[model samples]
Target chain A: MNSMKGKPMNHKKFEQMILTPEALTSEEREELARHIATCESCRKLSLQWQKASRMLNKPLPMAAPAPGFSARFAHSIEKRKEAEQQKQVRRFITILLVSLLSAALIFAVTYYSTNSLETIIKDTANASAQMLFLWESLKAIISTVTGFLPTVLLIPFLLTAASAMLTLTLLWLVSIWKLTLQKETVL
Target chain B: MEHELQQWLDEAMQGKEESFCRLVDHYQNGVYNLCYRMLGNRHEAEDAAQESFWRAYRNLHRYDPSRSFQTWLLSIASHYCIDQQRKRRMTLIAIDEPFEETFGSNSPTPEHVYSNNEQSSQMEELINTLKPTDRAALVLRYWHQMSEKEIADTLSLSVSAVKSRLFRARKELAEKMETRREEYELHERETYEPQKI
Candidate 1:
C-alpha cells in the first residue's frame, strides 16, 4: 500500500509528466518509466493516457458533405444577394420619403410664418440676392489679399492648394466607393 | 492543384459565384469533418459547415494570401464551432448522443463498423466535455495536425496557452476514461461475485 501511494512529490511530478509526455526529457522519461514500474496508480494513468492519445491522434476518415453541397451554397448565396438588393431598395425608398417629408415640413413652416405666398416669394428672392452679394464680396476680399503676393509665388501656391483639394476629394470619393463595396459584400 | 486553387480564389475574389462554389467543392470534406468533430452530430455539423463557407465567401477579400488557405478556412470553421458550443452551453441539449449514421463508411464487416461507432461515440462524449476553446485547440492539434504555433494563431492564443489547453484537455479525457474503467470493473465484480454469498 505504501509502495502504491509512492512519494507524494514524485507522484505529482510523474502525473503531470504523464499528462504531457511529449514535454518529457529523455532522463525524465526514464525516471518516470522506473517510477511507473512500482506505482499502480501512475501506471494506470500512463496506460489510460496512452490509450486516449492513440485514439485521439489517429487520423479518422474525413467526413464528406452531402452531395450537391456547392450547388446548395450557390443557391443560398443567390437568395442572400436578392435579399440584400431588396434591403437596399427599401433603404433608398425610406430615405427619399424622409427627405420629401422634411422639405414639405420646411415649406409649411415658412408659409405659416410669413402669412402670405407673396411675402414668402419675396423673402426667398431677398435671401438669394444676399447670398450672391456675399459671394462677390468674398471674391473681392480674396483678390485684395492675393494682390499683395508676387505672381510667381501666387501661381504656384494657388496651384498647390488646388491640387491638394483635388487629391483630398479623390481620396474621399475612393474611400466612399470602397466602403460601399465592402458593405455590399459583408454578410 | 495549388495553381488551380489560386485561380479559383482569384476569381472568387472578383465576385464570381461559380468560382466560389468550386472552391467550396474542394474544401467541403475538410471543413465538414472539422465541424462534425467539434459539434458531434451530422445535422449541426452540416449547418455549421455551410455557415462557415458562407462566412468565408463574404470575407474572402480579407483573407491574406500568404497564409495557407486551408488553415484560414479551418480557422473560420473553428471559430464558428466554438461560438456555437458556447451558445449551446445554455441549452440542455444532449451532445453525447450516439451518431445516427457513421460517416465515411468503408468498413468491411459489422464488427469493424460497430467498433468504429463505439470508439467514435466515446470520443464525442469525451470531447464534448471540454471547454469550447480547449476543444478547438485539441481538434486543431490532434485532428487537423496543426502545429502548436498554428493552433495558437487559429485560436488567437499564445503558444504556451495552446500547450496548456492541450495538456488540460488530455488530462481531463484521461481522468474520464479512468473513471469509466473503474466503474466498469466495479459493475463486473458486483455482477459476478457469486451473488455476494
Candidate 2:
C-alpha cells in the first residue's frame, strides 16, 4: 500500500523483491520503489542488492569443458559402440560352437543307426547275389557318409547352436533389464 | 523447433543418443558454471556438470516443459551439486580433518590476515564453505540474477522458501562481514591506540 495514499504494501513481499533480482513488472517496480522510499530497511537492502548485482554482473570467467571435450566424448561413445560389437561377436562365436557340437552329436546318432549289424548282414546277402554289389555298398556308404550325413549332422548342430545363442542373448537381455530396474543411480 | 526440442528431449528421456549430445552442447556452459560455483573445484565441477546433464538426460521426461528449460535444468544441477556437497561433508567429517588454514596459533589473527590479498580469496572460500543449498540460493539469486519465482521453480521449492533462504543468507553474510570489520578495527586499535594516547 502507498503510505501517502493511506494504504500499505506488504513489507514481506517488498523484501522478497529485494532478494529476487531481475526486473519486477512495472506495477511491482513502482510499488517496491514507493515502499522503499518510506522503508529504511528495505532501502538499505535494495542498495546492497544493487552492489550484489554489480559484483555478479561483472561476469566472472566460467571455464568451458576441456578443449577436446566434445571430441573425447565422441571417442568414448565410439569406444562403447566397439564394446557392444565385441559382445555381439562373442555371442556369435558361442552360437557357432554350440551348432558344431550339436552337429557332432547328430552324426554320432546316424553312425550308430546305419552301421548296425542287422543292416550289414542284409547288405552282405544282397552282395552275394550280385558280384558288383559289394563295390556298390561301399560306394553307397561313402556317399552317405560324405554327402548326406554331414548335412544331417548340420540340422541338429544348427538347432543346437541357434538355441544356445538364443539363450545367451536372453541372458544378456536379462542383465540389461536388471540394470534398468535399479533405482538411485548417480545418473 | 522449440517444441520439437521439447519433443526430442522427451524422446531423449528414453535414452536417445542424439538428444543427449544435442542438449549437452546446448547448455554445457550454463550447467558448467552452475556446477563450478557450487563445488569450487575445477575437477569436481566438471564431474558434477557432466553427471547433471546425464541425469537430466536420463530423466528428461520428468521435466515440465511448461517451465523455462534453463531454470528446470539448473534445478536439476543444483540438486546434484547439493547431494555431492552432503556426501563430501559427510566424507570429510568421517575422515576427521580440518580444511587447510593460513592462520595458526603463532600466525596473525584474522584481523592481520584481512590486510592481505588472501582476504578476498578467504571471503570467496568462506562463501564456498556454505551449505550447497544456501550457496546455491546465493549464487543463482546474485550471480545468475534469477527471479525468486524462477529460482523457486528451479529448486522445486515454494517461493517463500527461496525468499526465506535469501533473507537468512544475506543476514548471515552481513554478520560475517560485520564481524570481520570489527576484528580489523580491534587490530587497528591495538596497533595504534597506545601511540595515540
Candidate 3:
C-alpha cells in the first residue's frame, strides 16, 4: 500500500517489474516510483527484489560438452536410424514367412482331409474324452492307494497340498500385480 | 541473418543433412547448456540435447515456421530433460564429486575448485531442490534470458503458468538464501565473540 494515497501495489506486480523492467510502461514506471518513494515497506521490497534479480543475473559457470560431441551425436542418430530399418526388415521377413507357412499348412490340411469337417471334429472330440477317462482312472487308483494310509498322515498331506496351492496362488497374484505396474510405468 | 537462417531451415526441411548439421553447430552450445542447467549433469545433458535434436529432425515437418526455431528446439530440450528428471529422480547433485567420477561434476581446475564462491554454488544447489518443471522454467527465464512468452510457448504452457512456476522457484531460492545468510551471520558472531573475550 502506498500509505500516502492508500493504494496498494501487489508485491508480485512489483516483482514482475524488477524481473523485467522493460515490461513496465512509462506511466506504470512513474506510479511504481511514486509508491516506492512514499511507502517504506514497498521501498524495502523493491530493494530486496532488485537484489534477487541481480543474483539471478550472475554469470553461470558453464562447461562445454566433451570434444566431438556433435559428431558422436550424429553418429548415434544414424546408428539408431539404421537399427530401425533393420528391425523393419526383420519384421517384414517374419510376417512373410509366417504367412507362407500358414498357407502351406492350410493347403496340406485340405489336401489330406478326405473326411468331412464335422466327422473330423467329432472324432477328435471322442479321442479327447477317452484320454480324459484314462487320466481319471489313473487318479482313482492313486487315491485308493493313498486312502490306505492312516488318517493322521493323510491330514498332514492334505494340509501340505493346500498350503502349496495357496503359496502358488499368492505368487501368481504378485507377479500379475508387478507386471501391471510395469506396464503402467511404461505407458 | 534470420532470412539466411530461414534459407537453411528450408533446405533442412527438404532433407539436406548438411544444412541440418549447420543448425546443430549453430545451436548446440545453447541446447547443451539448457540441458545441463535442467539436468544438473553433463553426460545426461549431452544425451538429452542429442535426443532433442533427433526428435526435432524427425518432427521437422510439424514445426511451424512462424514460431522461432530456437524456441522450438529449446522446447524439445526442456521437455526431454523434464521427462528424464521424472524417470531418474535426479534431485541430488553430486557437485563435490570429481569430474571424472561424476559425469558432469564441476571440473576440478585448481582455480575453479579453490576459487569457487559460496553464494553462486549455494544458488546452484538451491535450484536443484526445485521440481523438474519449475527448475526448467527458472533456467529458461534466467539463464537463457527467454521472455515469459517464449518460456510459455517452449514449455507448452500458458504464460501465467510459466509466471507462477518462476515465482514459486524464486521464492523457494530466496528463502534458502535467507537461511544461509542467517547461518553465516551467526557463525561470524560466534567467532568474533570468542576473540573479543
Local accuracy of candidate 2 as per-residue lDDT tens digits, A27-126: 8888888778888777876776564444444434444665554444444565665676668767877877786666546644643454547744764566
Q: Which residue runs does candidate 3 get wrong by more than 4 Å?
A: A1-51, A87-187, B1-4, B97-118, B181-197
Interface RMSD of each: 2.4, 7.3, 4.7
Query: What DockQ does candidate 2 have relative to the true complex?
Result: 0.10
lDDT of 1 by residue, B63-155 (tens): 998888888898899999999989888322356565655345455487876776667666767787888888888888776788999998888
Which pairs clash (backbone N, Cα, C closer than 3 Å) in model 2?
A: A1-A8, A1-A9, A99-A161, A103-A157
Candidate 2 vs candidate 3, lDDT winner:
3
Question: What clash pairs does model 1 have?
Answer: none
If scored against the real structure, what TM-score would every candidate get? 0.67, 0.49, 0.61
In model 3, residue pairs whose N, Cα or C atoms come closer than 3 Å (at least 3 residues apart or on different chains), thus clashing, are none
lDDT agreement of model 1 with the native: 0.77
Q: Write the per-residue lDDT of candidate 1 for residues A1-187, one digit (tens) a residue.
A: 3265454445767878998888899999999998888888888889999988877866565666778888888889978776876686677557655755665566556445634566457656875786688669757866886989886577555545545544554454455445544644673
For DockQ, the strongest prediction is 1
Worst 10 residues of 2 chain B by lDDT: B91-100
Model 2: residue B17 alpha-carbon error in angstroms: 0.9
TM for candidate 3 is 0.61
